[model samples]
Target chain A: AQTVTQSQPEMSVQEAETVTLSCTYDTSESDYYLFWYKQPPSRQMILVIRQEAYKQQNATENRFSVNFQKAAKSFSLKISDSQLGDAAMYFCAYTNQAGTALIFGKGTTLSVSS
Target chain B: DVKVTQSSRYLVKRTGEKVFLECVQDMDHENMFWYRQDPGLGLRLIYFSYDVKMKEKGDIPEGYSVSREKKERFSLILESASTNQTSMYLCASRYAGTGTYEQYFGPGTRLTVT
Candidate 1:
């Protein structure tokens, strides 16, 4: 069974700074995808970024990027120039090659300090 | 832009009451999902349907059932509500196409079973 783990239960970042949320997953499949989703107080889940397992280059979307280490099974999210709006619960997710469904990790609540 | 909408943003139901959560996507997505989100648990998939009238059980399908009578609508039903089931319910949809790994989500419904 594939399982994702987010180690930090809570993370704090300053506005205009940077923060990284750690996530690791256990899976045997060689071809898969990793994703980071942000849920704000409005309770809307928004896709932040995604990384393909076969791609050596990490995926970047605006201020959000991922450090995808397929060998270590680590897929961490990095938020650069964090804004107050970045404060939200971030979740890491995994999907197999079939892309049927996502396996999410225990989320990390990110707090952006001004 | 893909738009996924839930029937309610907040719901209060009594114990043992039957609960129905409806989700509709305007993008005509082929895959729809129901997930339960709790603090520290991220999101756990309950059920998913790849097509109309086709459903599949996810990681945690107990005490939950689903219906997909149309391609864009997916409904999650709780046979009997319980306090433990009081959590945020999220609906998601994805295009069942190769290389389309992202899932669009709706504003969640926070169901409080008292």
Candidate 2:
């Protein structure tokens, strides 16, 4: 079974700074997908970024990017130039080639301090 | 833009009562998913539908049932609601084939079973 783990329960970052949320997963499948999602206080969850296992290059979307280490089974999210709006509960997810459903981590609450 | 909408943003039900959570997507996606979000647990997939009248059980399908009578609508039903079922329910949809792995999510419905 594939399982995702987010070790950090809470992370704090100063405004205009950078922060990284750690994530690790256990999956035997070689071809898979990894994703990071953000859920704000409004409770609307949105996809932040995604990376395919076949791609060695990390995925970057605006201020959000991911450090995907397939060999280590680690996928981390890095938020650069973080702003107050970036404060939210971030979740790391995994999906196999089937892509039916996503296996999610426990989540990391990111707090942006002004 | 893809839009996934839930029937309610908040719901209150009594234990042992029957609960129905409705989800609709405008993207005509072939895959729809139901997930529950808790504080420590990011999200757990309950059920998913590949197409109309096609359903599959996810990681945690116990005490939950689903119906997909139409391509764009997926419904999650709780046969007998319990207090432990009180959580934020999220609906998601995505394209069923390759080249697209991102899933669009709804605003979510916070169900409180008292």
Return the TM-score for candidate 2, rounded to 2 decimals.
0.98
Model 1, A28-78: lDDT tens per residue?
999999999998987689988989898999999999888888999999999
Q: Evaluated with lDDT, which candidate comes out highest?
A: 2
Kindly report the docking quality category of candidate 1: high
Once superposed on the true structure, which residue ranges of model 1 sit more than 4 Å away at CA? none
Q: How well is each residue in A1-114 modelled by candidate 2, as lDDT tens digits? A: 999999999999999999999999999999999999999997789989999999999999999999999999999999999999999999999999988799999999999999
Report lDDT (Cα) of residue B17, candidate 2.
Answer: 98
Q: TM-score of each candidate?
A: 0.97, 0.98
Taking chain A of model 1 alone, its TM-score versus the true chain A equals: 0.97
A92, model 1: CA deviation in Å?
A: 0.6
True contacts kept of 2: 0.89
Question: How much is the lDDT of residue B89 in candidate 1?
Answer: 95
Number of clashes recorded per candidate: 0, 0
